[model samples]
Target: MPNIQLIAPCLWFDDQAEEAAEFYTAIFSNSQIVNITRYGEAGHEMHGKPAGTVMTVAFELNGQPFIALNGGPAFKFNEAISFQVICQTQEEVDNYWEKLSAGGDKTAQQCGWLKDRYGVSWQIIPNILLEMLNDADTTKSQRTMTAMLQMKKIDISELLQASAE
Candidate 1:
């Protein structure tokens, strides 16, 4: 039996598992590809994948283990499940937003939420968002929520300005 780690997110892709794994490893710190599994003749007929084709890739993103499966086009990524990227600064948020949104569905981008080229939804959140939303005063949090809903990318300064109102 494979020594599987407790629980790790598995991303499904249409023959782009290796590409997606490479993309994510480049995006986050403390990341690397741990292993890659290829299909073999034994399951070629059952899986319908050619021998030697990539089956899965195990990788780490910000030290979190994840697997990307080249599971074909029977399924696709949707917005129902999204990965939240908590950033310490607006620069971090902007950088990720720009990188992740490249070649993706730009029309679907709003409220700091965007689908990457792989159709994977991601939330690029500013760290201050938590503090703002958790403020002791509900009005401040409400105002912050209002500000957040108005923008495509989160603006820390703007959120602060709204909280001040």
Candidate 2:
């Protein structure tokens, strides 16, 4: 592991760290729950959690380390930061879009972005979207960008057709 990844991202949840960790592990491939720590009687007064209640969950998603904290509802997820899942095929994009967006805010979806049930935003983007949008031909790139702007989940076929010379 590199020093950069040693500082893994920590996600905050309102008393749902274990549940969220389980959900994420189930969704992403090559993932597992590493460890879980629960609150004890030693700090119940400061933490406000009952003894043995889950305080933190450490897990990895697609080999990337992550920590889920059972923090209170003083914070909420917004669009300012999001994890980007770059996919090589439409099938991959569609699968992630369907699973992650289940029970999520549908109206918030636009241009390959969706907010999961936990309110964490994700971008299920097709790798081709970048290639097409970055094409040397300005017209094709513009067309590809326009087509991408019209859909919630990325469609590689449409993006390819839009960029066709």
Candidate 3:
């Protein structure tokens, strides 16, 4: 037998790392908290305080593994890199988009691009997008791409319309 384990995504938060982890776990199915480790007494950096103050939390989301670290203010999530979620239907897109865009600024793009309250960027796109963009006709793909470039949250119906000559 071979020993194999899946790697998990690590996310750093200023102060709401735990809160964010909880929120995310609640949103996705087949997700739960694995562990919550706090700092130790005589902490190296957080000395003389409650050592274990949610140092780390392991959780799963829709079978995807993730780890949240309660690190001090050092780095913040920017719009440079974002997570892209492929949805099967319009309902899935709407569900995720609505929740993630609740307190964030929204820019209507062709495909889908949304920024959350934490300034983190996300893409809520449909799985069919790939097929539409990879159409045999180059012009169709180009049109779809153009449409996506103009909007923030991608609407599948619109993409289809744009791709259809």
Candidate 4:
């Protein structure tokens, strides 16, 4: 077999690393738990504690690698950087929006941006959004962008309608 190496996004949680990993894996298709390694006594320096205490977890979401670290609650997910998921259809957008918005604050911005319960920001955008943004007609593209700027989560149909006008 070919060398199977994966570099995943490692998330640090305040004692909720496992919970968050499970939550994320369940949300996306083609995803599953790969491994869960706890801290051990010998690896104190690696984890700042004895080994066997959930030092790292490896999981996959839609074939994307992700790791969760049970680090103490020193920092949190902020709006500065967010995961942008491009949906091929409006239904996909709606599904992610509904699921991610659970127990989280929802803000409707022009293009597409919403904050989840974990205080993590996400942008649920339609796949065609980029195409519309790069339309040959600058005016139309600007109008679409303007419409998107006014809302939080993007509605592809609405954006297309706005661009047509």
Candidate 5:
């Protein structure tokens, strides 16, 4: 048997668990749908789902395991919790941002954070941004933060320039 991750995030969705899983798998390179469980006639009372309806979808994004559940609209994804994707280059950041935010909420995009079409929040951050923000020079760090706050998609070159100034 394949070794399973100790912990995995379970996403609650109204009825788009499979769709969301496919969307996410397409976005990440080393991703795939591991398994899918459907609702059976045994528990139609509590779940209110017909037999054979998709109840859960197990997937992996870049090797990180996640389970998407069709648990009705009782819960939603909010900014309080987010998955951060650290990119080594600007091209990587741009690629993820463009693909993840294709049909997402435009207004929610700020400081490299965006809400996807399925309402999941993602932070597309550059690796250098973290280093610059944690640098000993407060001026450089502050400048980088200020520059970052003013943009939706993170620009690594702009951050470098701001930090130098």
Candidate 6:
């Protein structure tokens, strides 16, 4: 048996597994497509995909393994499951937010959460946001939360100012 991690998230897509894998690998550093699996004659009736068509693309992002599966239209991604990207700097948050949200649904954006073109929800969050929200000072945290609720993409400086206030 091949060595595998304990858990790996599988992203279901309607025949866009390879495309999503490539897009994700390009966005994050130290990421790449690890393997590709294709459909075969077996189970053709149920799957309805042609033989040799991409069935799954195994990939990694920042060393976390994931699989993009061409699972057809029976299922879809929802905001209930989101990948939270904890960034240490404002630039990192902005970079990830811009790339992940491109060509995505604008109406889905709220409080640093966005649905990508592939319908995957991502939370581009600054690390300091958590610290501020968890602060012992209730007033500071409440103010920060209020400021965060009004914006789609989180601004670190604005959050800092809100907490100070």
lDDT of 4: 0.80
Candidate 4, run of 10 with poorest lDDT: 103-112
lDDT of 6 at 117: 97
Local accuracy of candidate 5 as per-residue lDDT tens digits, 107-149: 9999999999999999999999999999899999999999999
Candidate 5 global lDDT:
0.96
Model 3: what TM-score? Answer: 0.88
Comparing 2 with 6 on lDDT, the higher-scoring candidate is 6
User: Which parts of model 5 have CA positions greater than 4 angstroms off?
Assistant: 1-3
User: What are the TM-scores, per candidate, against the unseen true structure?
Assistant: 0.95, 0.94, 0.88, 0.88, 0.97, 0.97
Preferred candidate (lDDT higher): 3 or 4: 4
lDDT of 4 by residue, 8-88 (tens): 577778777788778877789999889998877775765585556677788998988888888877889877778888899
Q: List the residue pairs that clash in candidate 6.
A: none
Candidate lDDT scores, in order, read 0.93, 0.91, 0.78, 0.80, 0.96, 0.96
Q: What range of 10 consecutive residues in model 2 has the weakest lDDT sum?
A: 1-10
In the order shown, what is each candidate's alpha-carbon RMSD? Answer: 2.3, 1.7, 2.4, 2.3, 1.2, 1.6
Q: Pick out the ten consecutive residues of candidate 1 with the lowest summed lDDT.
A: 39-48
Report the lDDT of model 3 for residue 86.
88
User: What TM-score would you give candidate 4 relative to the actual structure?
Assistant: 0.88
- What are the clash counts of all predictions, listed in order? 0, 0, 15, 19, 0, 0
**Cα lDDT tens digits for candidate 6, 109-153:** 999999999999999999999999999999999999999999999
**Candidate 1, TM-score vs. the true structure?**
0.95
- List the candidate 6 regions with Cα displacement exceeding 4 Å: 1-4
In model 3, the runs with Cα more than 4 Å from the true position are 1-3, 46-49, 107-111
